[model samples]
Target chain A: MLEVSREMLAKGTRAGLKTTWELAKVVVPTAMLVAVFKASGLLGSITDFFAPYMGLFGLSGEAAVVLFSGYLVNLYAAAGSIMALSLAPKEIAILAVMLTFAHSLLVELPISRKAGSPLGYVLIVRMGCSLGAGLLLGVILS
Target chain B: MTVLWEGFLQGLQGVWTVARVVIPLMIILEIAQGNGLLQKLNRLLARPFRAIGLGEEGAFPVVVAMVFGLTFGSGVILNHVREGKVSPEETKVIGTFMALAHALIEDTIIFMSLGAPLLLLILPRVMVAYLMAYLVNRRNQHLSLPEGHHIQGIN
Candidate 1:
């Protein structure tokens, strides 16, 4: 009984730390990038280019910032960007789905590549899925 | 004095709100991993993945990573890779698929909060992504891998 209890406690502590680590990846980047990107106005330029293309997938170009940024940062950063901007309901949903399949290629790639799977194919699949899902939904609803 | 205090209060409130949501999610995902339930599920799903020449046991990591954020969900996969249970080749493939998509839970919630149609948006989103990744990974595996390379990073 004592052994079981001790094991459970140790497990709980590890879980807590792991979760904290995951949350921090999101929260920290969001806190830092909020002001920087907002002030830089670069988000607008990137969105303008991606806007028409993203609209092909049922989203606004401006919303592309969240999707594109999702790859460099994590969902928290994407969420932060979403909060900063005023996205249409449909646009927000589409962007959300697009990011779901692909986020933070940089951070994840090294670890994944180290794991030794096909890097290029994964990118293609996610991008294809993102575009397909995004546009199909965009057309039907929006 | 009043404005400064007000600002401080709002900041504190914001932090607290974020903390509330993030903390619970982290804990739940952690338990999901710690209990070894994930591995059992992965082995079950591995069969379908194997039909395409990918490992069936990958199902667990892919599902978790899809539902949770990669940071939150990839621990089990990482543990396996380190233990040499998964070949490095499989890891790269899984990593790529995951990079393109993971953290389905938090993601759909964000969309829900943003006023997207959860049923229409979230459901098809996962199905399509998973399908695509599986197909692409399978098709691409026909290529000849370099010879004389021993798999690395296992214990």
Candidate 2:
């Protein structure tokens, strides 16, 4: 798979195209669900439920959706939610930190698989670290 | 179909924002990859990573991929791993770390519009991802798997 090699270059290009098309297909269906969720305002109550914990992380209720969704989907989906919602400076910064450490389960899983990763272990470790670090950072910042 | 239409419209919306920035930046980074640079950078990072149990060469691509945006850039990095340029162990470490957090550029930019400071989020995330990756890498090194599973790098 040496990208410098001609075959890799072509293969990589094709893969990139496949990725783009795949992303489009996946993102749309997901986004529609997200849109409905937003329209119904179910997220608000959920955000409210998580607000205190998130606030402990120095983020707002609205931001929980952004952080959680970003981890479940991709950054774009997270951004789409962030865009439609109103957040304070503290909230967005917290999100930035949360996202900085995690995003887009769809993309990372396949790559991990290709690399012969023990995915469950890796994910568990990463999740624990990300949440702990995010909380720590939030405490320090707060 | 409605979902498709809605998604289609949202996809269009992406063009004007995060995609515009992320796509260009990814190209710039790819074009900028250099063997000499990778070699030198890997050497410098080796000691730090050695302490964490990672082979030297795994440093830069994973770091850059994490610090940048994950979707596209990380995908590219994944492509490299598949090519055997990054070993399975290294890939695990990188994947573990980056999975925790990657794509700072797009995330920061997107959040900034909603009122967050780009630096505030970026700095903490990078440091945490690196630190956690190092620790996990160190922990794993103590328990060796079968040999010959190592992925070769370009340099």
Candidate 3:
């Protein structure tokens, strides 16, 4: 049992290190970009444009950045954006649920197709579930 | 220049925080996999999976994806489909559910570290994915495509 555990620990550490490296590659660069956007005041205009729609999900306009990153780029990018901002826990929770249902579309959609699911079907289901999750969580949490 | 520098520093800090959460979680997941925990989980999930139109074979990929993330999970799925262990209909159901809720542990932890509520983050996605997949399975059953219309083996 001890031997098995030691092997598990070694393997887990290796996998952990690799995964963290992958995450850092995305998170650090994206976070810096978002911070640049915030510092330069670009984020404000972007926020203003998205605020009303975001309000439907009980999130601030700034959350659009997180959602956009998660949708187009990947979840680590979304995390970077989230770190650069200050949001209430409630809004974070809402974004969390929404993104879980529909992040990383450009990559995962094709993977689904290659697994025998249609591209269009996966796309619609993901986006629909994301919006639906956001809406429902918005109502319940608010 | 100051703004850029500050941004770089903040990004590093964020990476540190996220790394603290991610690395440990990955280790725990690895240990679980080493213990054959996933097989037990697959068995536990098989019945509920069938309610959404997946079989014993289909449940493995979905469970793997739910834990590991879609990219890895889809590899198992593709292998199973190629082996004829999972049908097109089953693949569609797996895709629907996994699309909505894959990578549950890692994604949820990342959000939780950012102050998202844990239960709120997980429960809703699971519930929504199950409900949506169940609905799609029902619809697929009714539509029952003509013999040749099934997506000829995925490339």
Candidate 4:
């Protein structure tokens, strides 16, 4: 019993540290970059351009960073951008819901292919689910 | 405050929020692993797996992917495929489900830190996975694989 408890503690601490470090590494830099964009007024124009489309999802244009980064990179990148922005809870929920349906496309697409599922089908399902769910959440949450 | 400073503070605050949630959650997950709770959960998944058209053989990798994440889940699927324990059609179903929703616990908490609704994350993802997998399986039921079709693109 004692040995089991000790092992659980050791495993937990190790996993916790690893997760924390990975999250911190991504969050810090992305947060800084977002700040820089805001200060330079770059974010404003970017937001303006995307506002119409993003508004469909009930998110600010700034949320494009989170969604696109999540698709092209990974969840950590998306999470970094998400954390940097000061969004309302509803906006965050919408973005989060969309991302859950689709994120890390480049990496995961091939995995699906290797698993013998057609890549095109995988893309359709992911992208379809993401946008469809996003639109739904936008309407319901907004 | 300068936007940069504000960004930094926000970053720190976000990190703090994530840390508070992630650290303890990770610990509990690890303990769950140690205590065999994850395996039990995997076993408990059989009913849902059946509802989604995945056989008993399909449940392990699906549960692994949900609990652990993509790479681990796919790796397990590949292993079982090689071992001849799971069929390609079933693997396709598993792959579809995993694509829709993997890494449930960790991903949920991370997003929750940013104030996303917890139910929105888990419930929809699960429903989508279940629906998609069942559809994929039903659609492909009549299609037979070519003889000796090895797992493709897995090198």
For candidate 1, what's the TM-score of chain A, rounded to 2 decimals?
A: 0.72
The residue ranges of model 4 lying beyond 4 angstroms of the native Cα positions read A1-4, B1-6, B144-155
Task: Pull out the clashing pairs in model 3.
Answer: none
Expressed as tens digits, the lDDT of each residue in A1-142 for candidate 1 is: 1123445556555655565456456644453454355456775677777777776777777676677668677665676566556677667777777776666777765655544555676567666766676667678777
- Regarding DockQ, does 2 or 3 come out ahead? 3
Candidate 1 residue spans exceeding 4 A from truth: A1-51, B1-18, B30-35, B43-47, B54-97, B106-122, B136-155
* TM-score of each candidate structure, all chains considered together: 0.67, 0.65, 0.92, 0.90
Flag the better candidate by TM-score, 1 or 3. Answer: 3
Give the number of the best model, judged by DockQ.
Answer: 3
TM-score of 4: 0.90
Residue B32's C-alpha lDDT in candidate 1?
Answer: 61
Q: After superposition, how far is residue A16 of candidate 1 from its true place, in Å?
A: 5.9
- Model-by-model lDDT, in order? 0.61, 0.61, 0.86, 0.83
Instruction: Report the candidate with higher DockQ, 1 versus 3.
Output: 3
lDDT of 2: 0.61
Evaluation by TM-score, superior candidate among 2 and 3:
3
What are the candidates' interface root-mean-square deviations? 5.5, 6.2, 1.7, 2.2
Q: DockQ of candidates 1 onward, in order?
A: 0.26, 0.26, 0.66, 0.59
Ranking, TM-score, top scorer first:
3, 4, 1, 2
